[model samples]
Target chain A: MSAISIQQIVKTFPGKHSVVALDHVDLLVESGELFGIIGPDGAGKTTLFRIIATLLLADEGTATLRGMDVVRDYKKIRKVIGYMPGKFSLYQDLTVEENIQFFATLFLTSLEENYDLIKDIYVQLEPFKDRKAGKLSGGMKQKLALCCALIHRPDVLLLDEPTTGVDPVSRKEFWEMLGRLKTSGMTIVVSTPYMDEAVLCDRIALMQTGKILQTDTPQGIIDSYALQLLAIGGDHLYDTLQLLRHFEGTANCFAFGDKLHLSLKDNSYSAASVTAYLEKNGRTDTTVEPIQPGIEDCFMAYL
Target chain B: MRVLLFLLVKEFQQIFRNPAIIRIIFIMPAVQLLVLPLAADYEVKNVYITVVDNDHSSYSHALVNKLVASDYFVLTGYADSYAQAMLDIEQDRSDLIIEIPGQFERTLVREDKATVSIAANAVNGAKGGIGASYAASLIQDFNTDIRTDWLQLPRYNPYPVIAITGSNWYNLHMRYDLFMVPGILVILLTMVGSFLASINIVYEKEVGTIEQINVSPIRKYQFILGKLIPFWIIGFVVLTIGLVISRVAYGIIPEGSFGLIYLFAAVYLLAFLGIGLLLSTYADTQQQAMFISFFLMMIFILMGGLYTSIDSMPEWAQVIAHLNPVTYFIEVMRMVVMKGSTFADIRSQFFIISGMAVFFNVWAVLNYRKRN
Candidate 1:
């Protein structure tokens, strides 16, 4: 059974200059799968999460979770979905325990009923239970927010950039926790701008400018890049890029970190011939080698 | 219902966890109820006066002496001329100025009526009226005394239609403190409950907590009720404290049924909390909510007959006062406390408050968005 099925979803904000936040976006998540939406800022990842969480209505699409429509069955949908927003949005003035209890009671449950699910996270906050939420550290606040979201034992979890401002160590810990949550057969849909985190997800959708460019396994997307790639770097990186653009057998030349990845227009040019040609042009110490494509390489290729 | 209880508990924890906000929510209301009533009084006393005795005669001196003898006026200093007296008035050193024209006793004996010019500061119209009346009465008494003994004229009471009938109601002693204490209590409750509740919710919206709650399983009505019930109870508790202090310190107590008063108070508190929720739906920041609530509170209290009787206002203002909830609350409170009114007597006010509560709560729920 599909945990979440979104078909041709479209959302637009109205004003003098209307913004089309999402455009014909379609996605499907199998039951008990951890799916990630990988995109930069303003890539409509947050909009899609909000719609699936039943907090917003789409303009021209139908989205269902476990055969329940997001709009018509919002009350029932709210009971089974845990949503952590991009920002830390708990009551700042209330204590950590108080915020948790408030949200627990909001779902007609108690702390004792959900203690097992949140015990690991809540124990870290127990020492500072009496302290105001505003006085907590960033990582501790993130944990508290997660506890509040998961207090009801939700069947599906939707997190919008949960690790945006957290530290590196905390980000690693958060992903480990998500891995543990996946073992319990909870379907999770997470959005992130970090490309490194994309490897942890079972599947990911690479989005850009309100459109999904590709949706596949991390390895699958990397393997699908069809180009003859070569990394060229020397003393003159910018001049090498200009020289490569003018080269007779070059299709596309773009910089990637210390080296530039260049695609060939046709497979006629040899590596030694290109190197000797650069040396004759007073460009020495230049190295040329074929390289395997990664996700970042694939991203640059599409751009 | 269970969610409402949780929200109320959370609100209490939020308020109690911060000492500064606790002081503001609890102690400030007590101070306003106990201390501010004494400080804010309209009854003028010990008004400073400057006298310009231009006549330099016994009659002029005696008139100045009489004016100074009255407890209402204090002779601050003697001015050299009317211009100096006017200067004193402008400088706020004196509230009243007395100028005695050069009229010896012989002139009053011959002319039968001597003129005395008095200038009063009319910026505060009530103080000016009282000062002018007191001065005029003193002069009239002096004229009567002269006519009876020194002039050797017929023993007659000049301006003899002196009919004195005094009446007092609600507050028999007409203590300014009694009149002001309840009004200040009303203002304090309005600030702490309605204004504070609205501002608190708006602050959540500004900081993005409302979005969090929107995504949760909490219904819109449950969330609003949760935010409101806690503040409503706090407002009631604060009002009770104010009442106890008024009774202990000022010896004031309600002569009517306590249950009836609380019923009215509960309805009134619901109206106020509803208003706070409505304001929260319209505002996006704590500062905007506070400013708007303060503005509305000022308008309501001013028209509430807390400071002045609304009946004395113009027809238009009186009509507006009927729409103000504070006005009806103050009226009901005074009636029950001072006149021993019952629920039947205040049923009209009760209906108005209930109507306002229902109307505002429904409007607030409608305006409050689950998605934004």
Candidate 2:
């Protein structure tokens, strides 16, 4: 059996226009596996996490954690799953140690009982234990929130965009902490908008506009691209993007950093042929070469 | 029970940490209790009077002295004509006018009949009516004095008289602060209990900490109780401070038992705090909570019979006053403090408040949903 299973879940927010937040979303994760939900803002990632956390009821379908139904067995589910929301939800007026102890007492356990589970992250937050949660830096606040959520040592952990605003060094340290937690046999499910973090997960679901475009391992998602790709580098990049969009037999072209990744319908056109064509169009400075695709390249391909 | 204890600890810590809340809780009652009773006095004094003495006899001079001596009236000055006195009334300088008719002493000596015309500016109805009554009673005293002197001459017979005497009950001397202080204490207790409890939960919602609590395993009743007990205790502290101020400042001690007051206050706090928590459940922000609480409190306090007598209100307004929880507590405070009413006297108020506590708390608990 899977650690988490969601079937045909649909949620809509009633308003003047009535936004459909999730549309027939289905997913599954095996035990002890690190799953990632990769999407941009407003892509229903938070909505999905809220449903599994039992804080929301789906309009249509069912979700379960380890075979317990979300709505029917919510009381049981709440005891076994640790959910950290996207917003900083701990009491800001409380000190870091008080915030953690408060949650521990609510869960009917003390910090000394589950010290081993949160030891790795709590050590990083020890220096600021007496400081108010609101007074800490952005990264320290997230770390304290994580420690509060992990104090009970639940089997399933759901983190919603935990690293959205952290500095680069803290973001790296947070992932390493999660990596250690995962090896202890906890089923960790996380979400992020950064494509680079998606590579660290065991499996990822690519989502956009309340729908999942693809779900697979990082290597498998990259290998599924069937078109020949080329990178075009030159001065006047915006002009080059426009020129490549209008070029004959060009199937897709997207700006990726300094280079433009382009795909062609006909494989017969080589890098030398494309460069010769650009030179003929009064473009003096240009270079073209074939290259491999990354996860963002696959996401843009799907879009 | 342990969960409730922890929750209470967190609530007390947060409440004491905020300087603004500390000031509101401890200092506001002292300032308002000291200032409001002094300012809210209803005894009418210093009514400006303009006398038009057309009769320049010794009798007229005596009447002017009598009117000026009464504390209720301040003589603006004597006007030569009634028309000139009317000018003072028009300019808002004088509130009442007494016109002494011509031949005032001659008529009283011969036919024993005299008339003095009094015209008052009735724009301020209370001041005008009370001033006119005061002037009329003083003149009656002077007439009796002259008739007594005539009776001593043995020419005029003294008529048989029947005098009516009355006594003021519950508040002798008719001190207004005695009436106002107890009522103001009720208002202060209600504001502290209901307003603070209403805003407490909504602040958590606005800051998104409610979502964390909702996702936890805490039951709905436990959460609502945790929010309720702290303010419930604070309500008693405010009531105690108010009682002390009334005693030390105005020399007031409750004629009834202290146990009865606390018994009534304990149930009253539950009912009002339940109302506040009910409002918190329906509101998403502290501003929304405050506005809803304000709207209800305006109706509650105004119709609560603190500023005006409930018996004097229109029948429809009387129904609203009876329905207000604040009205019952204010009445209980007055009955216990002023009238020395015992437990048997306030039996109905006690049961009604208990019912309201159950009604509002049940509604609040049912309305506070853990999942949405």
Cα RMSDs of all predictions?
Answer: 2.9, 2.3
- lDDT by candidate, in order shown: 0.85, 0.90
Candidate 1 docking DockQ = 0.72
Deviating ranges (above 4 Å) for candidate 1: A92-101, A110-136, A234-255, A263-282, B150-161
What is candidate 1's TM-score against the reference? 0.91
Q: Pick the candidate with the highest DockQ.
A: 2
Summing lDDT over every window of 10 consecutive residues in candidate 2 chain B, give the lowest-scoring window.
Answer: B150-159
lDDT for model 2, on a 0 to 1 scale? 0.90
TM-score of each: 0.91, 0.95
Q: TM-score for the first chain of model 1?
A: 0.91
Over A119-214, each residue of candidate 1 has an lDDT whose tens digit, in order, gives 878888999998889899888888888899899999999989988988999889888888988898899889999888998999989988778889
Query: How far does residue B345 in candidate 1 sit from its true spot (Å)?
Result: 3.2
Worst 10 residues of 1 chain B by lDDT: B151-160
